[model samples]
Target: MRLDPQKTEFDLGYLGKQSQISVYWNLSSPQLIEQSIINKEANLSPTGALLVSTGEFTGRSPNDKYIVNYQEPSDQEIDWGKVNQPFLPEKFDQLLVKVLSHLESKNIYVQDVLVGSNPQHQRRVRLLTEYAWSALFARDLLIPGIDMYADGPDFTIIQAPTFCADPQIDGTLTKTFIVIDFVKRIVLIGNTQYAGEIKKAVFTIMNRLLPGENVLPMHCSANIGMQGDTALFFGLSGTGKTTLSSDPDRFLIGDDEHGWAQDGVFNFEGGCYAKTINLKKDLEPIIWDASQSFGSVLENVTFDEDTRLLDFTDSSVTENTRAAYALDNVARRVKSGMGGHPDHIFFLSADAFGVLPPIASLSPNQAAYYFLSGYTAKLAGTERGLGCEPQATFSACFGAPFMPLNPVKYANMLREKIFDHHSSVWLVNTGWTGGPYGIGSRIKLPYTRAIISAAIKGILEEAPSEYEPFFGLKIPGIIPGVPSKMLNPVKNWESPDKYAEMAEKLKAKFRKNIDQYKGEIDSELLTLL
Candidate 1:
């Protein structure tokens, strides 16, 4: 409500500008709703409707009203290269009195407040809050209007909620922001948090507000568990990242997002940001309970006091229906059980394209090749669960959207990690068998889970998984549950023409990406493809 808070500014000129996409959102704040109405320059779409408290996003949701609010070109708006400079609450030292003068009455219960940022955007406030600071009425805040430009000079104005926090209070800053001016490669977005089961797990995620680290942090699902010592799982929004990771037999480390550290991998938050859409009690019971907690923030679920129930399928929260809750929501929580160098890095390809196999083991080079060549197709509205129409897309990583590092750099890391850790990674196609994506049904979640579980267990490397020499691994047994013919795309499909055409198109796309990496990758890795 007030803009006069004296704010401490961070000079994040590390990554440069125009390289990253920045976000200024609160974990849970009414101010976000307020900004939509107040800031005309802040480019906001009613996308928050996906995060609204009302039924605007519920079933039968009308066509999107997400009109871009800010009129500035993205180039001038987001500076991916600048680091997130988080100073002491000194942020408001200059504007405090002015800001304080503006607020009529925010919370009389509040007294003191402070601010911080993560230069690398690798740290999280909520997860470490218990280990650090002391405050009253402390909550995440956002200012959409000012976010259109840089935070340092032009407008150091930060729209933070006034929290009565004590700097001298027992804890140090819960979140610390720093710059990683190292190599710009090895950065991939979305996967930073959601890729689980057997991933290059990075838990201590979400650093500074806009620290340009040449990397991107995104939201999705992930799973990884050691079988003979290895973890791996992959699923898109509806595929089953949650179902597979909830395996009772595994020593469940934190699920969802994590960060990489010199000491291995650490979970970013104490929780998981799970989708509650059409959430089935039989499948996602854990997320259901986690969504109701005080600290838990609901994205776009319809909340009704009279019913005391959340209609998760309601798009009002987000078509995603997410719940950001501590991973502790599960009884068997692993504070830091993962991050051992991956012995098997699996990249899941939910190919609505329907041209790939049910599962294909790969050599580190092949793995790297595919990882950088993220290939998949979306089923007709399966992404939004409507008849919206299917489409195809490819990225260096399953999550190219949030990657702060370069594709080659990340591929190099995967190569190095695979070799150093001797990991066995794979590219599993959970797409179609009988036909290409649109006409065929997606592989059943249960069957997909069985295959993934088997893959983690080395079952794929056992008997039936015929060895593919170039791939550096074996394709094993059909693990009783799934239809035997479905295991191989060639067998499951009645026609190979469609599969061939799709494969050719993908290969051409892969070839087009070749020149981009010709100079970055090693000769041998390049030769593998």
Candidate 2:
């Protein structure tokens, strides 16, 4: 098979002989999009956005993920267990050979990119994909500032979505697998075309490598205000990290992964991968407009074939429908993809229990405690097996799937950063209020926005506050443009007794979940729980 005549100097010799594959290296977005259309891999929307549907599996397959338990560094460092499952090196090699063999007769697209926005910590990543659309996705989600001809990649990701592994032979749990061999600095992905896997695999690598360099890799969104005040929003999927940080009033640094270093926070990605399900133009005009722009990659989003228009409300494909576009697509964003140490840090939780106040001021210890707990409700379609109902869950650091180290590592880093920067941390509940998920209504977007705005503007610092004894959160008595009663969850509830019961239940869940990390975290932080 012939290699693309326009190939770069990046070598593929280490991946055994690749004589059977037609390798297309470093194709531009337009070229990749055109290839995708020619190969019948994706369709062009009316707005010129590339629309692709990830068949069968629409979300990440966490159960099938693994990390090679090869010697040294990774073996001793990675907190290997359920989250970071171990895969034998031999098995990885076998799977790699099989995957490469499968790709022999097919076209493979390669992209050379960087992972971090800051040059100091930037990681050269080379992505090899079976589909042209997947290569376009990698280009859209990753920092494309690297010169492929200059140096080889620090890490390589080979994704073959069409190559299904035999669970028995390949040592995979299923046909789908995402295995990371840190020692080899290579990642393997198969059977799943949910583009997010490609994005998050790089994040997982950063999470493992950054901590040692004194950089706290985070699963959060960040923005800067007019006065140059920067704010961070940390939360799990469907908790509004992307939505809240895409504020028109502020300049966005990045929408997903970031690294908080000694100087400031720098984004890990060059783009924003935003959830598009139930997306409203009125509420999230920035993301809405970006999703409708040309060169953006829309994954699993429903559209009218004749009109070529997207229906953001439709969830038949999957609620996890997403839009991937470059950071430039956003009008209000930091061109450098970096922000100063945050003045305010918000831990957003979609508390389906509805017992948490709409907004609560968090002490240092409280912030660390909540950060480690990473309490949030698992919304439907965010992952496989989650039904329509929201289920209360604790994902340490709000990104346990991507975090390879102990939760305490990130928690301690956050505590140190918060104390070092004198940043105010707030627990903002974007979840249901008044009652539980089904019984109570979700908090209004406008009201949540008002509370966040007030906090960022430092309007609620000296506001009259009352302590919530159950969680020990200080609830603000008043917020500009929001009803005072809405700030206090107990007051919004129909039955105070019911709210107390739900609060107690959630408190128990927190204590139980945090117990696993009891010995590692500070006893003082535990007391805040």
Candidate 3:
């Protein structure tokens, strides 16, 4: 179905119904593509994808994101800190009035979508954006609204990219802000043109709201084998969640954002938003093909002046350059976007320190520990203002920015699910090896794929295993396709002494980061430190 401008309706409380605003409701993808070009908000790439530039901000402004501290009894459960920074409800109300006032007489695009794949625990979302391109991004990423005439949305997002916040008056850190009010079930975004802010605002909300219902929200990728064995790939940005899960032999459930229920895992998104910086056709053919499709949206990606051919290798625009396309754009995607309870889970990390093993199996206790630690390296250009040098990062559950509850809340859910489903968990390092970054080269993609293939084929289950004391991970002594030297990271290092030195340093850092959780979590699991 397509939008009917004549029949468009809205409430005056949030939006002035009598104003000269042109509200386009529920437009189809084709309509949005055509409108975006006509409005000159975006251009058409040579590959037929919609191309748009998110000026100034190409990545999320995490520090600017605030959660309104309404002091509701339920909000007392929220673990508030720098990541889940608090905002005054009075400030939020003032900002809402200003945002709604700014949109009074301007053209806006509205969309209704669903956030969760499982109908049993889905959220009805209503999105209102100032740009047609942003509306298309939301429509392509989230499930289309099922009941067009349904009642009020469970959550509403009002985004005005052009409206700048007054730091002095708004009590904000910058001219841009992303504020989420759980009590009001509303999110307000201003001054940032980044479309990811819209998608992630909802994700952060889900990460906060879902755990209370016993549904574990995750920042991971999932795929299923022909026999219905589901596997999850967990990692931070640049850790290869999108790259590894696009396996030709498997059916992809989703590339990011999923929920684990009592029955199984379900994707939260309807499409894949993949990083496209320095992308090579031979390296990641699945993502390359999807980026060239008709209905895709390319953000901050540049093309040749005459040929219009994308220069994926170029980082002049930003390394966070991205491509958004429907899940069906990929050849081997699961149609239902639902999978059996994950039988296997893989935690991926690009260990810049080069001390962790390339691949290691984990016991239930060890899995809980590492899962809570959620260790990885943040590559340069992955986020706004990040330098070229890789920096060590420890985000709980691999997604600290989105997690509002205590880390133990998520860790407990993962422990319960793994035991209930009898799932096997493994830690895979897709990062540098032999030595730290600059000294050692990154792990080859082919080798990483082979390791994952063996794990999925059950090759590692019965293989000879060796335990590493520092991280407490069980290393598989031998695998059919992988090199034996690569099995243990320390073996390939130039100096065994230096390797041991670095390993001990990382273990110390892990302890320091999780010390705050000691009183709240299982003390036995912390012994893995």
Candidate 4:
């Protein structure tokens, strides 16, 4: 196998010195795009974004993910259950050998990047992928310009999309597998072309490791106002974390993952991996324009074959369509990718049940309660096996699949940070209102934007608020540019009695879900449920 003459001076001996793999190290976005097209792995949109299909798997397969249980202190700390499933260390080693053997005689792409923007807490990562576009995805989503690591990467991801695991022999649930060994500081992903697994695997490692260093790793988007006030938006996929945080008025700190240090909050990524299903130029001009720019990677998005024109509204392939582009593509992004401690935090929930208020203020304990609850509808296409209808689900910390440690650990850290920084927390519902899913219309984007803008400007703090007894949330009576009637969710429904019934049902769900954390959390906080 021939190696690229421009390959960095880093050693590939750890992967196997005997393997004759052609390594293409640290290729630029344009070069990667060229390779992608040449390899028939992707096509270019009219505007130059690389368009590729993720094949059968368009979303993450949570059940297929695992963490090796052999690690000493780290393995014992992992929340060992379905989300943080345990895999045999020997099995992992066997699978890694097989995956590396599969890559032999094939071209591989390597990218050395940093996970955190702040140098003090940044994690060095070395990503190896079988596809050029996959390497580009990593480069686009991670901090680049790391020529070499002095002591090797803090974590190394080996993604072999074409290499499938044998469930019976490999100990994986399926042919697709994502196995991370914390002790080894290595991640192995097989039989999944879904690029999200690559990004999320890195996040999972950070979630597991950051708490030890006293840095709170978060699954949220952050942006700063003109006055330099930072705001955080937290939610699972399809709940508007990306859309809400990409405010035209504010400079985007990061779109997805972040780390809150004692000094400030820093982005975990150098780019935004935004959901593009039904994206419109007028509503989300920044993301829309970025999605169409050169060097961007559009995954699972449909386009006109002959014309090479992208149709953002097309969801025939999947509603989980995504665009991965560097932060430079966004004009209103923070160049440093860091922000002061967040002054306000928004917990975004697409309440398909339509019982929750559009926006509500939370006390400290209530913040912890709701943070642990992390309620949202499992939107269609966000995960595999979900139908078109939305299903209500609770993901602790809004990212249960990625969080390896216990939910209580992150909750406690968040509460401590809030107390130290005096940050205000608000619950924002970007989901349906007036009624549940099909019967009700989604809360308008402009109205939600208005609510957030008012909150950022401190308009809601002084506004008259009414007690929402069901969940004990403080609902503002009015928000600037938003209809007063829309503030209270029950009033928007046709039948108050039906609304009451639904509210009671949802309240019961919150209680049932939080029951797991009964002894773990403050008992007084449970009363808020």
Candidate 5:
């Protein structure tokens, strides 16, 4: 298949088709790599492969390999269960059935909740809760929504499909959740809800998978509709994933979570979950204003019902206090809510230790590490908040919770997509500067947002004379319009001694955490610290 280095031919190209998936492992031909192993005192046919996207080509070779050779399953056909224990618990089926009934019975409660709520909040939660439950039942009922693969690994994925735009409703979910039991060589699609629409999407797409052209399931937020190709920003929650990507210059696609189809990137959450702690007007002025309205969900916040004054610093509700608002809340949102191929990708991380540079160019390995690390600091809001103090938190790929179970598995998929799709990846720190965590304030959201804008526009590609190497990125000739002193974390400390103390303190924390997972990581990768 002809590949565009720049994500330009979106909506109308081989990549846009449903058969084109981001594979996680390399493939020999149309069939996946498999092997046999002994388990439970019996020999079984274990899968030695993971899934990946097949790039445009007549035959598979270098450009289209992502499936990883790992342990295969003993089952003859696709049984998602044979892979491992279900993420659910004993009798989870019964428990879930009860919850579904409760939701239906309390449907009136949801409607009542809507009475005092802004229409935006109502719609956002409705979609999230609906999809969550739909996938749950769809999986149980063996419906089209939670189907499995046709030819590779056995697992389920969250997929939203496209349908003829509904003239009545603003937007609607076309494709539901789907499971691809590649081991069975079958794609089980979920279709309980939106049957007419979902069928329109899956059937139209599935029949088109060519020998090498494919669509590997991916879990990342992506958007298109900017000036040219849609630019994608990949990072975990606190890495400014939402803050940095809401560019005013381009049409805003979805935020938070997305399902990447061969055609374009679509959002999972119909809304945004922005950090509300220490939120101010200058940075995210629009989102900032969204805090007090009827639509937002104030997490651990204190407010006056009569006066309408809000203390953004307060966290009385819950640590995960968030402002959940629909993407359409901002007028600049795209209608289809998906973007074309991306031209750039910026991975955000909040490095509290201040040991690494502010920015760095990522080698594919470093990109995988950082992405797996999902680097960021815990903040005042969010369930894991440890107060406003920033601290280094490295998750396997990008601090995403679902990592490690399939760290190498997911990384291979994402890496292949970026490269074959010709997407660029950059590592950026949004944590501390002069002092780590408590000693320093977060890299201002407004300033960080500006830097990201500059970077995405290709301004930082040339590597300038007056650039500072933070980690991998060259902080370009100090981003104008922001305080120059703030750009250099080293100088921002209250005093030299304070800076030294913070660095040592954070270093100790890093060592403690790294040691816990020492066995799993190779010393070579660990030596970078």
Candidate 6:
């Protein structure tokens, strides 16, 4: 591999010249695999994929993430609390020095990559990591470096996973820290070894910056039909966003992270980071095939010692087992990873509470209401602290931690876009039915897929519909392959009284969440509800 010395000349003014850095620039996937093995950082699976364990942290540490309070153009614009916590600029400088100091004599792998498939909004990103596998992970997930030295980077990330922080000195709650200074276009990551951090930090950056430009960034899966119609699936982890989007028939644009711009919907990532827990080849052929590929990275997944076969059922490490692979590996995927304006947008919810209908059509206001509510169960192992059991939660726009602006901003943008594009919105519950979580069996994947197919084919559009009183969602009375009774949650429940009780509890939760966004939300949405 040819080392581009020009790309190495990044302006690391915070890093001193005395630091002896071994820089590996733009290494090919095979070269990176060799380096990882040489450095004892990764083990190759029998399938030839790179397998590595993220020690201690199997998921994202949201509490430790913070953005520097630069008090500039973005200070007031940033929604500053909890998810978007503030870090003093002084503390950031101190920590930056500490991070650079630790990496002074270490071998650092650098990948100058690109984000955003749209040419107009493409962001060149420079990633520096202490681990070769982490660098490869970034390369697998982000757009590869090609003429990146000429393109230049919009943001520079310095990641030192082994470098620990002092809470008392750093003013951080924990030893791990993910500090971002948008003002300086720099990201500092320390202590945490989870690769998901790298993926999400960049997403947070985009979420913060894109709205001001009138771009609606979404944490969803998107695909285009053969006829050029595009569809988007929005949901939290384990809600089948990745699973449903990888349909054998549709052309996948991307599995996650997309932006709805004036021209169309463009992918923000070059790859798909898919949850592999209980993944069966027959169920998810696309992702399953990709996970077994040579360049893909498997995180916290178990494999047999002798056969070296993966055990998707194993959750000893974490249930949030994942596989990261480029989009090209999928059997059917868009070449450019960009799609025309989406004609159908489905809000996916793994309704563990089992009160939501299997599939329902939503009005514009209902779409905005549910979008802001972002109602879904928290999938275990997706975050730093979570279990396999479903936990009901509301994340604004389905990506609260990543959104920098207020929830209403994204909701408003989505409403405007839906109106302008004449998009049809549907609510899909990929969670449970019969009863909540343990009481009921999880919804079958085939059934969910059939329901989704009906929506995508526009069959549900002409179907007879009935109003789901609590949520005010228009439940279709019949779908081609779906059981007529399953279309409405109330009918599936053995006891109507219990169904009503559970539905009321969920409605209360929704009301409580929406109350926080009272003035910002349209009164029409409330009336529809």
**Candidate with better TM-score, 3 vs 4:** 4
Give the worst 10-residue stretch by lDDT in candidate 3: 12-21
Tens digits of per-residue lDDT, candidate 4, 98-155, equal 9887877578888899999988888899988889999999988988955767677888
Instruction: Write one digit per residue (lDDT tens) for candidate 5, span 1-529.
Output: 6322211111101111232222111111111111101101111111211111111111101111111212344222111222211222222222223323333322111000110011221111111122222222121111121112223122222222221222123111222222222232222222222211111122212212211133322324455544656766666555676666666666666555443446645543445556666676776766675444332333334555455466666644533434545454667767555565566767766777664445555666566556656656655333221455544566555533322134544555566777767776777777767666555566666677667666676766763524333233334446545566665555676786666666566555545545544555556545444
TM-score of each: 0.60, 0.97, 0.96, 0.97, 0.57, 0.96
Q: Of the candidates numbered 3 and 5, which has the greater lDDT value? A: 3
lDDT tens digits by residue: candidate 2, 129-228: 8898888888888877446635467888999989999999889889999999887788999998888999989999999999989999999999999999
**Per-residue lDDT of 190-246 in model 6, one digit per residue for the tens?**
998899999999999899888878899999999999899999999988888899999
The candidate maximizing lDDT is 4
Off by over 4 Å in 5: 1-90, 94-226, 289-301, 307-313, 384-388, 403-405, 463-477, 482-529
Q: Lowest lDDT 10-mer window, candidate 1?
A: 127-136
Query: Which lDDT value does model 6 have at 465?
Result: 90
lDDT of 1 by residue, 67-161 (tens): 11122443233223212222223222323333233222221111111111222333222110110000111231111122312322211111122
lDDT (C-alpha) at residue 463 in model 1: 41
True-vs-predicted CA distance for residue 313, candidate 6, Å:
1.2
Worst 10 residues of 2 by lDDT: 2-11
Query: Could you tell which candidate, 5 or 6, scores higher by lDDT?
Result: 6
Candidate 5 whole-model C-alpha lDDT, 0 to 1: 0.41
TM-score of 4: 0.97
Please give the RMSD to the true structure for each candidate, in Å. Answer: 12.7, 2.2, 2.1, 2.0, 18.4, 2.2
Candidate 1 — which residues are off by over 4 angstroms?
1-230, 234-243, 260-262, 292-295, 303-305, 314-318, 337-339, 377-387, 466-474, 523-529
In order, candidate lDDTs are 0.42, 0.89, 0.88, 0.90, 0.41, 0.88
Clashing pairs in 2: none
The better candidate by TM-score, 1 or 5, is 1
Candidate 3 lDDT by residue in tens digits, 1-529: 7553442756645332344445888888888887888889988887678989999998888899999997888888888988888999999989988898898766788889988988887898999888888888998888889765356888899999999999999989999999999878889999999999988998998898888778999999999999999999999988999999999889999998999998899999998899999888898899999977987899989887677778887889788899988887899999888898998899999999999998998889888888899999987766677887889999899988888888889999999999999999999999999899999889999899999999989998889988877776789999877789988888989898999999999999898888878788878866657
